[model samples]
Target chain A: MLKIDNLHATAGDKEILKGISLTVNAGEVHAIMGPNGSGKSTLAQIIAGHPGYVVTAGSVTYEGKDLLAMPAEERAQAGVFLAFQYPVEIPGVTNAYFFRSAYNEVRKANGKEELDPIEFLDLMEKKLKLVEMDEAMLHRSVNAGFSGGEKKRNEILQMAVLEPKLAILDETDSGLDIDALRVVAGGVNALRRPDNATIVVTHYQRLLNYIVPDFVHVLAHGRIVKSGGKELALELEARGYDWVMEAA
Target chain B: MATATNATGEAYEQAFGALRAQGGPSWLPALRREAMDRFSALGFPTTRNEDWHFTSVTPIAERVFKVAPTRSGPATLSPADVAALVISDPDWHRLVFVNGRFEASLSAFAGLPADVRVTTLADALKESPEFVAEHLGKLASGEGQTFTAFNTAFAQDGVVIHVPGGEIVEAPVHIVHIADAQAAGAGIHPRLLVVAEALSRLTIIESFASTGSFGAPYLTNAVAEIEVGNGARVDHYKIQRESTDAFHVGTTQVRQGRDSMYHSFSYAAGAAISRTNVYTQLAGENGETRLNGLYLIDGTQHADHQTFVEHLAPGCASRELYKGILDGSSHGVFNGKVYVDPVAQKTDGKQTNHALLLSEHARVDTKPQLEIFADDVKCTHGATVGRLDEDALFYMKSRGLGAENARALLTYAFAAEVLETIEVDALREGLEALAFARFTQSFGEQR
Candidate 1:
């Protein structure tokens, strides 16, 4: 579903991702484990087309299209979703209203009919249960004054509603409590299918326990240093990234 | 204190003399001449003047031309257009003025309640002789105010609304001041008098807008006097959304009695140059007043707001909140002043003005002043002018919205806080619709 060859990206003259290459097909989950500032989040943001990062070299193809050439918003319309590590707060814009607009924006770009408020609200009702979110959160301004857990869950709720093909969970479990982590993991697990792929980007192995990945890749010094089965995460948790760095 | 007369100043003097020569009433023209002497004596306001610190009336001082006598053409009005200015209030009185002239045909004054007096200032000279004479030029004579004198000199014709003792205006009294664009050089001078007698309650909504796509240089000079008697309640709103090319200068002069409550809202969204000066005096003990204002300016338009609330008696309270949104190099200025006399003990007053600049070139200057001679008073003031929150913008853009759409949404929300301050439903909706249309047009698809 996605291909990256020799990905080298920098933000404001500082190199963050260097010649990193990866490929993921449908029905597969990839977990990228890295130490702090080891290009894990940078790779995720580049794949999702963050404007701040300049991909100085390399090529990226998502769903058979040249992803690097498309704008960030177009990539979003083309089914690329990035669950932020730090969700933004938009005052006076309700979550439901923003979600509905975003949903229709993507739908409209694909030559589909947009759902009205009633239809969208009905769709949200079904998805709200998937994320264990109530009706109260959707009515308030977008992410304004939301609890850390609530903001993360709200991001998950948006993912469930948008149904992106390749979802990038960029440290989605950082600020969530155990209950929220379970609910979020359950929500991600429920959305998995053979037709879509999920990329879990994190520094900890606890999330991998809940949403088990098919392949675990260790990223360090702006490159994916190692790739192995789920056992790789347990080994890294037991021995630490220094061991993996030496082994790679 | 300062003396300099340019071409505009000489024109003002000639115009002032011309108005006195065409005298219609006995006392009004005398008051006009007195206002002219006051204007000449004060000269045009300069930066040295404390109230004119943020706003420079130099542009207005340079323009000496006058608006045409009266519109000789047909004013456009559609069914949809009527919806923009009409209110369905049948219990109280209604008055409509087009180009500063009374429009009896467009007004609705049905089921007139007894003891309440309502009439045009022209007719009020004879109908309510005592009321007009007693309160013609009572307020609006500060140390240095040139525009106030200009407006008082041209107080040609307007409406006078008075609620008798212990009476209540069951329905809100609506007033619409329509400025015609096709007649550019033609000027409009109007005065509004609202009096709520002791123990009475009244609500007045005064609006200023344009009729059609008018290019004529229009000058709207207006002064509204509001008198709140002991234990009375007065609610007032000043809405200005006229032609983008028109110039508007208005003053709301008010006096509060003992234990009275006066509330006011000002929405200035129209004209190339729009300035509103509000002066409130708490003359009686334990009286309270509130001033809420909102302004949205873009595309070279300028909106200036100045306010003064004076506490002459003890135990009075006042609070003010004025906000502005400037885009496309537009300029907005806000100046608020609160004065407490030596004897006004236990007085409480607070003022805040917050502004947002959508474009880098857009400008906003704010100044808040509090002068208290009394030792036992509480007074505070704050002013802020800034751009949209960058973090908030990033948050919206992350939701898949473009920069333009994100900006439009945030700017609309910023102005909505002040829009929510409007108490009238129809008025608030109209103002919001206008603000929304302008916001989207500049930053959204229309751009």
Candidate 2:
């Protein structure tokens, strides 16, 4: 579903992602594990078309189309979703309204009729149950004064509503407690299908316990150096990333 | 203080002479004489003056305007057009005026209660001369105001409302002033006087709008004097939507008695140049006052709001909030001052002005001043000038909204803060629809 070949990216003068290459097909989940400053988040951002990062070399193709050339909004309309690590707070814009706008935009791009407010609200109620969110949160401002767990869950709720083909979960379990992690992982597990794919980026192996990945790749110094089965996460958790760095 | 007679000043003098030649009441001539003398001495306000620093009245002073003629036969507008301009609800009393002249055929006051008086200034002069003589030039004295002096000198007709003591007026009173361009350089002065007796409650909505596009610029000089008695409550709202080629200058003076509450909301969106001066005096103890205003201007339009609040009694509270949105090369000005007297101990006062600029060439000048003479008073004032939040824009854009849609949403959100302050739900909803239409036109299509 997605392909990245020798992706070289930088923010300002510092090169973050250096000579990284990855490929993921449909019906598979890939876990990119790395230590701090290992360019795991940078790779996710580049795939979602963040304007701040400059790709110095290499290419990214999504569904046989060049994803790097498209604008951020166009990529979103083209079914690319990025669950942000730190969700931005937009005052005076209700979450329900924003979500409906995004959903309609994507639907329009796919040549589907836009849903009215009543129709959208009916659809939203079903999605709210998937994330264990209160209906009151829909009326509140977008991520304003939200708790850490709530923000992460709201991001997941957006993912469920949009139903993107290629979703990148960037540090989705960083600040979540054990109960929230279970619920979030359960929501992600329910969304897995035969025609869609997810790339989970995390620093800890504890998340893989709930949403088990098919392949665990260890990213070190801006490159994925090790790829193995689900048992690799347990070994790394027992031995630590220092052992993987030495082996790489 | 600067008595420099320019061409505009000389033309006003000529107009005053003509009014004297065609006289009215015995007392009006003397008031006109005194006002014209004051207007001649002070002349038009210039940018050099501290009060008129940001707003220059040069455009008004350079033009020569003749006095708006009296009803030259019947009005040209149909009943449907008049109905279209009115607020949709019919539970209120409406006093309609065309070209600054009261139209008895167009007005409707079917359900007004007895003992409450709502009539035109011209009718009250003959019907209740003694009452009109007592309150005509009493509350809003043309002391240092040139435009108020001009209005006092030339005002022929307007709205005069009086509510008796211990009465709760359930229906709102709307006074609609429609300025039609029948002739070029026609200047009209419309005066309003509202007196609420002790323990009374009322709401007054005054709107100034133009009928059609005027080939030549006309002037609408309006003044409203409101007196709130002891323990009374009054809500005064003014909406100004004139023609693009028109110029409007209005002054509103309010006096609140002991334990009285007075609120004023001014929404300005039209006209080439418009200035509204609002002054409130908290004269008695435990008085409460709120002054709120919102202005939206684009193209080369200019809108200015000047406000002054005086806390003269102890235990009085006053708060003021004014917001402006300027686009293109439009200009906006806000000058607000809050003064606490020496005897006004334990007084609370706060003032804030915020401006959002949509274009680089748009300009806003805001000045909030606080003068506290009592040691026990709490007074604070602040002013801010800024553009849209960039982080908020990027956050919206990342959600699949196009650039124009994202900007339009943020701009609506910015102006909605001020709209939320309105108390009347119906009025608020109507204004919101108007605001939505305005922003959609100002920005592009909505997503």
Candidate 3:
């Protein structure tokens, strides 16, 4: 339920996303792979409503609504989620407290009743198990001193709790170890539904093994150079992006 | 300038004479005379002085505050009124002072050990003259300090707590000072003396607040001296919440003996002009000192905090963290100095001061001074003044928090970093609620 047409974005004086077009329907998982500085993360952030980038000549539509017109917080309340590539550390705020506040804000926006501490804790316990995280992590500061693997798992935990309609995972597997990658993928896989969609943006093909994608698109120089079925991922993994770049 | 100084000094001299005529202990007159002389010589600090460069005491120096008179009958405040000003449990030992005089009717302390004395300075002087003479004015000598000299010369009644050797005071001692309507145009001086003997453990909370809706201007000058005996532990907290038109100046001096520990926290959120000075001395080896403070001010309010930690013995550690949130045209200042003596090798000291400016006109000045004589020591200091982190705000907004809510939450979290270190459960919770409420009100006003 998402569409991007001729999306051309710029960050300051440099044009990052040039003439990019993509579309995805419900119940589908799309994997966007690219090399360094290929605008993979930029596309994800623009859709999530990051204020740092300017969409110069494009329109992004989500379920027949202009996504670019909404603010970041409004986008989040409307069931659009972005798992940051590098999560921000918020000192002096407990993880559980932050999660509860965020969950209630989204619920209130959607005309749902807010959960109290006890009710939130009950839901949190189940989500914590989904990511295989210890209960103690809830008491510590939000990602203040968490390891790279723990931070990734925490992001997935949040995804499970929020249950967004459209989720974008940007470099979620960049800093994870083998076990952490498997756990994060398991959490994402468990939350999949026919009415929801996900976009996985990564530089490596290893994460595809865990959460297999229905469509594979190779991005180069801010444009999709190749699009194919699941076998394209293996082909690109075996041979580098050199062939794709030459053909494009 | 000279004539104005003389005029201010003459007014205080007359007040000192009046206080002397009231009569006190045999040795009090001479001490008061010396303090008065020192105050006259030092006068009020001007902007020319390095210590007072950022603050201007013109508002305080222009007005003359008469010494508050002693109440012959019961105070006008009710028990409920006093309870609202204090942040402590009902079961804790409490001493309530109104207009710098002890209010015995409102104060209570039962079941305390016989050796442990939690009484007023006046009573202590009459009951144990020798003990009072030994410790009083020993640590906080008003030599070059103008406000300390003024407080020592005028202070008539205050709290005196003494824990004998090896006594562990399970309950904290709460001292509540209230400036009512009568305190307007009056000078109220409150003194505190805490002596924790060897191996003793003590916790003390001092609160300065105001009552009545008069909104008249006044002055509250206070002094506190703490002596931590060998291997003793002391936790001290001071909360200042005066009227918006009042001026508050307080000094706290602490001395830690061999293997002793001292932790001091200062919270300043009121008054038109407020200054708090905390000086700690690590006199013996293996001692530790911690000084943490937080200030939240708006409007034309001005808050200043000066801290000095001296390492006189080896293997001592000192840490300081002070944070301020300024809004409107308010001004905030933080000056911290850490001294490492030649004999104090292996001294570990760190000082950090941060200020958050919520308005364009809000201002802050932070200075960290380090004097290192020992060859081998670790000392570091940092200061920062800025607005809230934009990245952090965006991150919070991305999680569905409104922009205003994100701003207010970040500001509260910045203050909570220092507030969470408080060991007293009731006091910590009370201050946290106060900070939260303050941020909510301020942010709502912005909307």
Q: i-RMS values of the candidates, in order?
A: 2.3, 1.6, 0.8
Error of 2 at B48 (Å): 0.9
For candidate 1 chain B, the 10 contiguous residues with the lowest summed lDDT are: B83-92
Q: Quote the lDDT for B204 in model 3.
A: 93
Which structure among the candidates has the greatest lDDT?
Answer: 3
Clashes of 3: 0
lDDT (Cα, tens digit) per residue for candidate 3, span A92-137: 7888988999999999999999999999999999999999999999
DockQ scores for all predicted structures? 0.30, 0.50, 0.76
Write down the RMSD of all candidates, one decimal each: 4.0, 3.2, 1.4
TM-score of chain A of 2: 0.99
lDDT, candidate 1, equals 0.82
* Candidate with the greatest DockQ versus the true structure: 3
TM-score of chain B of 3: 0.98
Give lDDT tens digits, candidate 2, residues B347-401: 9998889999999999998888788899998888888999987767766766777
Best by TM-score: 3
Candidate 2 residue-wise lDDT, A1-248, digit = tens? 89999999999999998888889998899999989999999898888777789999999999999999987778888888888888888766789889998889888978999999999999999999998999999998889899999999999999999888888899999999999999899889888999999999999999999989999999998889899988998998998899889988
> How displaced is residue B72 in candidate 3, in Å?
5.1
